[model samples]
Target: MGDDHSAARPLRADARRNRERVLQIAQEALASDGLTISFDEIARRAGFGVGTVYRHFPTKEALFEAVLLGRIERFVADARALATAEDAGRAFFGWFARVVEQAAANQALCDMLDGGSQAGPQVGLRPGSTLADDFGAALGRLLARAQRAGAVRADLTGRDVHDLLRGCLTAERRSLARGGAVRMAEVFCDGMRARTY
Candidate 1:
């Protein structure tokens, strides 16, 4: 039984690698072509058999949710890293800009993360998922630190930060010209800064 288990380990590792590759390809395809891109296309791009893709993701919705969750998780990690920066204000604003840039590049992902009523069902993210909570906590920490440092307004909350980021999404959706979103982000950062008489 031990030998059998040991032998199966390699198969499991290979399966994990295949799943990761499929997800990577799916993200790129979905970002470039939207959800209409076929699973066969994703499989071809991943260099995996269609069966392998189905074996891992069963449905397009599942694959999409996986991709969305993976992206959110990475963003959460980035937020956490930014939380440790010496310049709290710079870290928060920098992360905000990065998120906006990402949203500009991948509008669908922005919609999913924004968790608007229209996007919840499509992305399979219910309210208060662990991923959402983690992201919120990270943002909360950053906001609190910036506020404490007197770099940002004390009245601002995590929800406010989220709303501002959503504004960036709106700008992107409107096809705001290049650098427009960054300028909007800068305006938001300026608004959030603590005022001195």
Candidate 2:
């Protein structure tokens, strides 16, 4: 019988590097150019051929999904690192800002992932292992800690906090820029803190 390991297609070291480069470039393109960036431009910038790019990511939607998912994983890992903040409120605000920024970028990703767009199906995505869930869990942990410390109100669930931030991100994109977004997040955080009894 053939070895189980050999049955799998092992990515050569160069292929692995190229794949990672494609993901990084895709993120830059999405951040700078939004969802409609050209896959051909991405391939040229990454020093990989069009075929190589397609080999790593089959379509434009797939490339965007990979970029979004990759950023989410990194965002989650970063949020977990904030579990040791000096002030619970600061910690909460810190991650709240992170979520807002990511969501601003992910609005396009959500359109594709949630069936709100015409982007074709993407491969390799599992049911629940998305950046959205990862960030949501991290935010939940932070919010719970903050509420327990009386830094946030008890009436607000993590879902409420997330939805609130999503609204802020979406709104800021249409009419405001980065400074407006920072102030908006601070205002929301202040409102979430419980007043002394």
For each candidate in turn, give its C-alpha RMSD to the true structure in angstroms.
2.1, 4.7
| lDDT of each residue in 1-197, candidate 1, tens digit only | 99999999999999999999999999998788877889999999999889999999989988988998888788889999888799998888888878776766665687677783545475843558887789889889999999988889999899888888887677765656454434566776788889986
In model 2, which runs have C-alpha deviations exceeding 4 angstroms? 1-11, 102-131, 175-182
lDDT of each: 0.82, 0.71
Q: For model 2, what is the C-alpha lDDT against the true structure?
A: 0.71
Top-scoring candidate (lDDT): 1
Tell me how many clashing residue pairs each candidate has: 0, 0
Q: TM-score for all predictions?
A: 0.89, 0.78
Q: Which residue pairs clash in candidate 2?
A: none
Give the per-residue lDDT of model 2 (tens digit) for 15-52.
88889999989888877777677879998988878999
Supply the TM-score for candidate 2: 0.78
Query: What is the Cα-based TM-score of model 1?
Result: 0.89
Stretches > 4 Å off in candidate 1? 116-125, 175-182
